[model samples]
Target chain A: MTFVFRNNTIERFFSDGEYAFSGYDDYGAVPEAERYIWWYQVPVKYNQEQLITEVESYLRRLQWAVSQVGQAPFLILSLELLYDAGVVRGDRRLVNAIDAFNQGAWQLAAEHTNVSVVDFGAFLKQYPAAEWVDWKFYFLSQMIVSPRLAGAFGQWLQTQERALAFRRKKCLVLDLDNTLWGGVLGEDGIAGIRIDGDYPGKAFRYWQEAIRELAHAGVILALCSKNNEADVKELFAAREMPLKWEDFACMRINWSDKAANIRSIAEDLNIGLDSMVFVDDNPAERELIRQQLPMVAVPEWPAMPYLLPAFYDRLVKDYFAVYALTDEDLKKTEQYRQNAGRAQAQAAFTDMDDFLRSLEMELTISPATEVTLPRIAQMTQKTNQFNLTTHRYTVDDIQRMLDHGARIWTLAVKDRFGDNGITGLIIVTDCGAVDTMLLSCRVLGKGIEHEFLKYVLGQLKASGLEEVHALYIPTEKNRQVQDFYDKNGFLCTREEQGRKAYRLSLADWDEKRNTIYKIV
Target chain B: MEQKVLMVLRRVFKDATIDETCSQSNCKAWDSMNHLNLVVELEMEFGISLEPEEIARMVDYAAVVEIVKTKI
Candidate 1:
């Protein structure tokens, strides 16, 4: 159950049994629970100074709660103090205090590993001040947040949960013509494509810039357009284009059907088609992808170019929320692009080993440290493809696994282009069973999975272990890795209902360390 | 009119078992907030905005139906 430290009566908002509250603005007894939320709304005090003091006191109490809470996630909500202080235009005291209090919350969040600051103002801004504070409910039940907006707040909370849990879609597959720019690139020349000066052009430019930020924050960008390859490439070559040629990790600028191109883009990026968000302005293209690849998230493109901001916001809220970017996630776009470059160069080499060696990929395996625990737990939670067993773990859960004698090896991979930091991991029980093994889609297609497994198993073999066991618990998104253990030669001991268990002797691990990887 | 009031009551209170005997004193779901929602539903159902005093006095299902009828 989650515990909310609230100032107002938010019980009606969060359902019963799902939450237990600390006294109104009271932070005395810190509850020991899995999820602790600081939801102290701005108190409705009349005196301006008193209100500021109350906000400050709430801030201090929140700090205390943050200190007392367990490693389980602690969410601190920013306070929205825009209640009646209406008509009193000159009184900036309450506004300043609210801003100060929110800043302190954010600072606390930055300092604490478990702290997450949810923007309450973002939710409150949807309603007017009068609607936000319903006098009837306020007088009757001390309900500051309007009861009418309860349903909307619930939805916003769900979005925050998705963001907090890192259940974000990984890649964004974009349509080039009317979606990214204002006009058709094939019809309009490179300079003719409307991306600036005009109304729609300015809006599209803003939308493209937002997408660029998503790419930098680790959402892989891909181009999937029906225009001639040369036409789009020439447009990308333009210096003023908001989205650059190099921004996209992969491209499918062809005359073929969009779904097929999207499928190939997913293949090249080594992500589940489900993890890709397909955005196109053409209704026919959108419908084709929807009918053909239902797993791919297809958000409708706004017919009016001016509505692009709203459309972009909806996409971010739905797909590209990077809750906490790891060092690898921050560098993902560049690494994926470099991986594409490596993939392209691989065709030149006749021998597989020669092609692999040309890339000079480095794989470093380290036991899980306190610093890497969060990312490891996140990988377990969010990673779908290339995962042997889908076991989502919290930080406490990961710690418990260590206490229960589980040896977790986190793998860090880097090549010629950039460092894909700590992208692969394997957890093994003392009895030599692979409890969990997964590689971030970024590190796949390099044959590093086998190398990671071989090295980890080699460590086990050195520790006087004879064999190891593994399991494949398939999920909708993890079907790509269903035969993962089987292909790696883990003899399937049992199979039922698509859930397979396997055992492999350490003696059989053919020292098949792909000579391509400098494994350490 | 009575049936419409009862239908809105069933929805707002989320209790299908609620009938004519249902009142603020008896129904566990009919709190002040639910009362506000109940008043809104009544107004929308009958296309008449009940005064604050009228909403406050609407303590029973029969009272809601009567007030709604008077407004109509």
Candidate 2:
């Protein structure tokens, strides 16, 4: 349940079943909830001293309220000073007070992991003060904000919730002709393709620049077009295209069907198709993807080039927002690009030895302690594609598993580029059966999975285990990992109704560890 | 104008059976808060400024229509 704390009557705003709110300026109780949001508007006041004091007390109360909501996300909306600054030459006092309140929110967010400041000014500055607040409404219900803007406010708040969770579409599958640029590359030619010069071109250039920034924010940009690959490459090289050839992590710049191409892109990136958002100017291509790959989000392409800014804003807010990007997130694009290289170079290597040595990878396996339990539970709940058995366990469920003598090990992978922390896990029961085994799709395709399993198997052998049993439960999303155990030298003991069971004898186990991975 | 008012009233109150006879007295949904919404909607829909006096007096549907008609 999401609870919203407010200073004014915000009942009319969040009445869409998305949130439950506190009374006007009431911060008395912080009820047990999944999430909390502080959306205190500027108090309607004339006396400067009183208003300043009110702002100070409001921020102090906000800090106290945040302390009550333990690890659950507390989104503190920044206070925008809405009242008219009267005919004074310099009204610094009220401005400074509001600034302090806003800055205090940022400082509080910095101090607490759960607290995040959603800039209400970003939404408010778009409208005039006359439209932002209705005097009639204010007098009647103490609603600080105009009721007309409530829908937009509610939508913005929901986006904030998504941003805080770091839950967003990972990949943006873009169309080339008319989508990113003005004209078709095949007909308009490389130099003739509109990306730089005039009205439509300038608009498209800004759109491309926006997309480039999103890529820098760790969104994987990929191309899916019904154009010549050679021509597209030339365009990337020819004109000053903001997004060049290397910008895209994956590409389907060929004549294949968009649905099929998108599927290949998801496979290439090792992400679920659901994490991809398809953008195209052509409605037919979008409709095709919608019909074929319904899981993929195909947003309506903007009709005019000038609408690209609005389109980009909506796309980022809806698909790619994170409250605060982690160090790993900043380096995501570089990692995915490395995966692309790995995919290309995989066939050239004759054995796993050649590949492992080239990667120079390191694996850190740690037991699931209390500190790591939340992330482990989150991964178990959310990881779909690479998950084996698709068994979801909460932090409590994982603790219960421990009580049942299940040794859960989390694997952190780091290669030449950077570190991916606690991305994979293996849960082994007391009776020597694999309860859950999954890897983050980002860290897969490398023989790291084999190394992680071998390390866990070594731990089991040291613990005097004879045989280990594992199951491959079939799910619609986990079809890629059905043959995982079969490839890892586990003898299939039973196969029925798309569920495969495997058994590996520890006596016959080869303790041959990959030389490249320095397992911790 | 009537249709637009009806749209605003229905949307703000989440009601459908509202009409010319609808007033603050007849509609439980049209409380003080929603009365504010209805007034604001009428002002925006008619492209007019409602004075504090007019806003206070606008308590029913017929009163809203008359105020909006004069303003427009």
Best by DockQ: 2
Q: Clashing residue pairs in candidate 2, if any?
A: none
Top candidate on TM-score is 1
The positional error of residue A494 in candidate 2, measured at the CA in angstroms, is 15
Question: Can you write out model 1's per-residue Cα lDDT over A247-356, one digit (the tens) per residue?
Answer: 89988888898888888777666678989899888888889889999999999878799898898888887777544567768877877787767766776899988887
Model 2, range A391-424, lDDT digits (tens) per residue? Answer: 9988999999999999999999887756777899
Question: Whole-model lDDT for model 1 versus the true structure?
Answer: 0.82
If you assessed candidate 2 against the hidden native complex, which CAPRI class would it receive? Answer: acceptable
How does residue A398 of candidate 1 score in lDDT? Answer: 93
Q: Residue-wise lDDT of candidate 1 within B13-68, one digit each (tens)? A: 87898899999899999997688777656655677766767877888987887778
Reference-based lDDT, residue A57, model 1: 74
Please give the distance, in angstroms, between residue A441's alpha carbon in candidate 2 and its true position after superposition: 3.8
